[model samples]
Target: VPKGVILTHHNFISNVRTCVAMFDITSRDTVLSFLPLSHVLERMVMFAYLYAGTTIAFAESIEAVAQNLIEIKPNIMVSVPRVFEKIYARVMDNILNSSSLKRRIFFWAYRVGKKYAARQLQGEKIPASLKLKRQIAHKLVFSKIIERTGGRVRFFISGGAPLAKDIAEFFYAIGLIIYEGYGLTETAPVLAVNRPGALKFGSVGRPIPEVEIKFAPDGEILARGPNVMKGYYKKEAETREAFEGGWFHTGDIGYLDEDGFLVITDRKKDIIVTSGGKNVAPQAIENLLKTSSYISTVVVLGDRRKFLSALVVPNFEKLETLAREKGWHYTERKELINKPETVDLIKSEIDRACTGLASYERVKRIALLDHDFEIEKGEITPTLKVRRTAIENRYRELIDSLYREESSVSSDDFPSEESK
Candidate 1:
């Protein structure tokens, strides 16, 4: 439905006030603003910074965030999960491509750091031996990773999408905390956020005092708060639908955990129900795949189908590096992606990432997309979230072929019922 949301000054003010207090933003903090200013999250965050008298630094572009981070030395930054994913991917790429000794050392440090972080997150006291090991891990590996973020970052705020749990843990293990939050433009935009000393890796934290969050029987998160808009512009039907049952309907499906923290699974509409009567979260699978350094973007699709498949955009830079190492001739992107070696590489990555996934949830096959989902192509939103229906429709032929008998991806190829 086409609708312009009407938000008042009071809505912005109340939300901003709560967020500022939660994050403890003050004049001493510097924020690197790179996400589109028109985005509700960025704009609302801008207001919060102004309220806190914080210093705001604008990057020349998203591509320049790394250089800008060094130049600005921002203490606090906010971004969507996409930015963090890229950062994680880049770091992993470098580590994986390094020498055998260096790789082993990095992994050892990572293990130690992760163990330390897990203990800290559980509110358990760290033993003297583990504390010493953590310090060594920071000096040898974590310090170098932190240096890329300007070494002054106190923490980062991730919203707009769910940060991959592994990525969150990796950063936290290295002493860079990502406090993931959950909200929407319709709610002026924040209902819950993880604050210092109350953060959880996967959960979005307890609901803020400013807003109330409940759920429908099916687990669609619902809210009715002063920050929520009264109605949509010129769309009475849509507005009524949004405010069905007297609550602002957030189409996101999630649940409150035992500790009162919010955990968003996936969007209600994005849930894929396969022919096997399995309800799979596409975003969960997509996020899991994106954790691989070789994959840049992926869209999982199996809605009303036999099993899961995906359209994957390979990280060409990493692919080219692999090609160079393998002595495989690769000049053009299309030609390189067509090679059997590349396909096998991606297949292995998918299989590796889908290790713990159930048979119904595992993506059995994927079509290698030469290009990524783009805003100009209407395949992605301004916030870079994939427009699933649009992409599925645009690539209908390719998708259909994946399901055809000739292209019937073997049940033995991946983790499936037949494999066991």
Candidate 2:
């Protein structure tokens, strides 16, 4: 699809109509579309572009997004949270790896900008002291960074995953309004989006016009609006299960704030309750762990138990690089993990990540695995989601050994312990 064209199934034309009417896009607008046409988000956006007579430039592939963005110099770009995270990480890495004075100045400017942005978002009138500092930071640091966003992007929208509050604020402070929205493939994928001048941090903004959002008794988000899909394709039973009464029952667990903003807590199915009667959301802990470059995968465990623990799979490549820099000899993954010094280093890193978590949700002990869990190993889904049940079963022995203080040696050294 190229400028002024739409690519989508006819069944979803209604959603396209809604988007076109809502965004008020025009022929002058250019959209660099690349998300799969089959997906509701891409389809809806593409159709909306056509309805507005807007120009659409399709990227060759996901890898070509940067080059395409530069070529297209799009006015709007919509992407999943993962894409934004990668860009943020790469930018931060570059800043950190710069010269000492540049790194310090970059961080100093970031802090000043963040404070100003936070105050503005909270509706606290900016003080003169902060206002002046923010102006300097914007000109000297933030503006240059924003220019790298193809120099023409006016709005950046994030969906699919929870956008970290810090990342959102950082971008906003730097003059980019990264609007976080909430929806699913079932709901034409755009129930609520933050509009210009009406944005809110932390919460997904108010429901879009014509969209009705409400909460279920169990905190599941429900929607009743024109954007709602007709039903599942050729699956009446499944479709019926999706809607209760008149609202589409979104399986995600979340709540609408007093101001009518949506705040997702976790998935209802992903909540874990410990034996001590403490409820924990593993996703929160997992998200924190992933902030560390060393930690590639983390599964927090304490369900029906006294305390939380974890099974971690380190990013071996990053760890090897660090080990070499620190003058440590690295051999096998297990050997590196079992090293007392390395284990302590990981413990400290995990502790830092879990600093703000509730005591019950904090990981008390960690066991590093030799390899990452993957779908091929029957430990993950094809979509790269963790197969919690399979992982728990496979690591049952190691988990049990971690809880047993009587064991003097590592679980791998004891056949009985390893066999479980």
Among the numbered candidates, top lDDT falls to 1
Error of 2 at 54 (Å): 3.9
RMSD per candidate (Å) reads 3.4, 5.6
The models' CA-based lDDT, in order, is 0.87, 0.74
Residue-level lDDT for 271 in candidate 1: 94
If candidate 1 were superposed on the true structure by all CA atoms, what would the RMSD be? 3.4
**Best candidate, TM-score:** 1
Candidate 1, residues 1-420: lDDT per residue as tens digits? 346889999989989999888888999998999988888888899999999999999999878998999889899998989998999999888898789999999999999998998899899999999999999989999999898899999889998888899999988989999999988888788889899878887898888885888899999999978789878888889999999999998999999899899999999999999987989999988999999999999999999999898888988788888899889986677777777788888888999999999989888877887677889999987778889999999988878777776255684442211111
Model 1 worst lDDT window (10 residues): 411-420
Cand. 1 Cα-lDDT: 0.87
Q: Return the clash pairs for model 2, or none.
A: 3-56, 275-304, 275-305
TM-score per model over all chains: 0.95, 0.80
Q: Number of clashes in model 2?
A: 3
Superposition error at 88 for model 1 (Å): 1.3
Poorly placed runs, candidate 2 (over 4 Å): 1-14, 17-24, 59-72, 122-132, 296-302, 311-317, 331-342, 367-420
